[model samples]
Target: MSNIIKTIDVTDSLENLKDVCDIENGRIAGKIFYDQAIYEQELEKIFARCWLFVAHESQIPNTGDYVTTTMGEDEVIVIRQKDGGIKVFLNACPHRGNKVCFAESGTTRGFICNYHGWSFNVQGNLVGQHESGIYEASDFDKAKWGLKEVAQVDSWKGLVFATFDPQAPTLQEYLGPMTWYLDALFDNQEGGTEFVGGCIRSTYDCNWKIAAENFVGDILHAGWTHDSAARAMLGGSVAKVSDFEESYSVNWNGHGYEFALDTVGNVAVLGESALNKYLHTIKPSVAERLGEFRSNMIGAVSSCTIFPNFSFLAGQNTVRVWQPRGPNKIELFTWVVVNKSAPQEIKEKWRKGAMMTFSPTGVFEMDDGENWEYCTKTAKGRVTAAQDLYIGLGMNSRASDTSLPGNVFKGQLNEANARAYYQQWFDHLNAKSWKELPNRNFGKQEAE
Candidate 1:
């Protein structure tokens, strides 16, 4: 056995790293959030290789419409093509590395670098440069000077994603069975979902993963964190739903969700008159299209995270991207999403409700930012960074059932989903290549 062990090559860099994350033991070192080296590695290995949500198709519905966003720390432009497809490119000029597009979002035939006269067409093809004679002495190929396009771009149910890795799996394959839960909000009607309000942006002094994990399955915090907001809106304390039937799910790639079996919208802070009436009227139609199980979830106020950074709240119809600024900061971009076919009043209600609950000035949003900021600030200490943070809640309590597609546990107030998230995080950090990623097994047994 000693000889056999000696023959095994152990040159992998991740193996040498200590205190990264121990998913099997359900412990995550605080340094992962405060360490500069780990943050840089995450940009290369995780963000660059993962399918990141860039924008909703509705945000750029017409040809030439575009939005500026980020993939990890790299600024990117997501644009609609004349061919009804979408394209994403690094938002930088190939000439002098200056930014090519400065506007947040707008419709344009092409982008012209403000720093220089170089121009790029809607397809990211280089069209012109100041005085063609400047490069006459050499072969300055315009075709090669086009914007640096992202390796892959795709959309699922109006949500667009892009990856810097050409070998990354298709968006549908990347999303996996999580689509079933996403459809609870996305596919509630025939027209699919559309972004209603303009995007809201805020900077938080917290690690990006802090927000991602919170959305994945942290319903436990809702009661305490948003207690004041809950009291003001509901005329009582945060409603106790401990007795309600709930479930949590985690996919192989770290996507996760937690939802309860509630008939009413749990997170809707808007007045109960118009929004509740509209949901009640549409409940049967939602049931018909998505089946009864998902229909029951339509207004249950679930939270979900699509692996690395995208997350949404179902009842509030708020979708956000937790854009990583660094190990200690995140830029959050939020938008209100509603069924495209919903009544105008219903859409407006969702828009206002999301603003009141999750926007930059939102009651709940302020509280969450405070907690995450303090957690991150305190982690900067040597003693705090050295401690092991426990995330073992409900570990090994998962059971298979027919109700959901991924690993489903019986209750919402558990950290099984968080553990699964860190498991995949460790996997991504350690993997030398995408091919080295574990297979799409949804259970702990299979993962082992």
Candidate 2:
């Protein structure tokens, strides 16, 4: 076996991706995020191989309840069975390779293969052979055949995850320093966050990475992108500060983000006065449940990603599952998350806030859709695809902030976050597995 993870030549189809850090001169000239070859490689090197976010534990609340999800392109069935624990299995039937269950989500005692009548239990066991008499004389061991289980599965803060690579680190370890930051959004409440409603599934005519990068890199666009909407609703929203542009830190493993303005509209689902009052009213309770800093950030909008595929706009309270449908097309699955323990009125307020700001009809979403669509159109051009893009902002970055979660940029508009994201993208693209990557890649604090 080759000791080093072999990498696709940076000069091949990815000829434009020249270096790990390239935010100087404000230039990011590459199609690495939207390339066909890179997308396929990600499915193998990153998606198929990494621990992917599958579903929230609450999605399967009762015995035999289940939901169909995806890890990269592989379909998985996550269910709550008799043992009162979550179980996940490849959605493919053991017989004839057909998908056993076709529903997007539901509760089930187990799945019966519609193709051949092979029944599998919630734990993915071949509990019943439809016709045992025909196979009684056969040498097949019933125990040997079960729905193919993902290599590894686990949860953190009630979020379900699974990995195709058996050797990848645990989800906590994989998340590294990001866990500390994520706790602000996911673990703040005593009961934690849960999906208020089912996810909204939509199709986008764009590359999956474009959506991923936008979450981390498009802080500059918020003010202008949603100017009309913000003006109509916010009427001089506080995020006008975000229009000034800023830079963010790059983290090891490429899980990073740019810190933008902290706005009331960005945080609590209620009005600014209501949100602020709630924080003050709940200060004692908030502190008792969550630390002071995390409590304060409850309503703050943060643009962040946990490397690989999971990306979220905390300010908007939207969790996006960017599932790739093809090289140039992607299925955008969005979920609204709210503190489960909050009062009915507060939950409803947050639901309204999330729907108006991030949903398919939200003004901010429509504003961004135009830009993303235009970019996608430009990427298809033979000339434009060959031309490189730029991401060099604050190239010789001169700031260090240990207290912050990841790398720190000099200003909010700096492209540091985008560079950090792409750097890790390159690292994953080049390395085959966690073990194959060099020790220094994760940096000291993040690696541990």
- Per-model TM-score versus the true fold: 0.94, 0.88
- Report the lDDT tens digits of candidate 1 across residue range 345-407: 888888888777788888889999999988788889988987889998887677665545766
List candidate 1 stretches off by more than 4 Å: 1-18, 439-448
* lDDT of every predicted structure (CA atoms): 0.81, 0.67
Q: Roughly what TM-score does model 1 have, to 2 decimal places? A: 0.94
Model 1 Cα displacement at 141 (Å)? 1.6
Please tell me which predicted candidate would have the highest lDDT against the true structure. 1
**Candidate 2 residue lDDT tens string, 256-362:** 65553343336643344554555456555655776665555555556776666678866456788788876677777888777687677766666677677777787
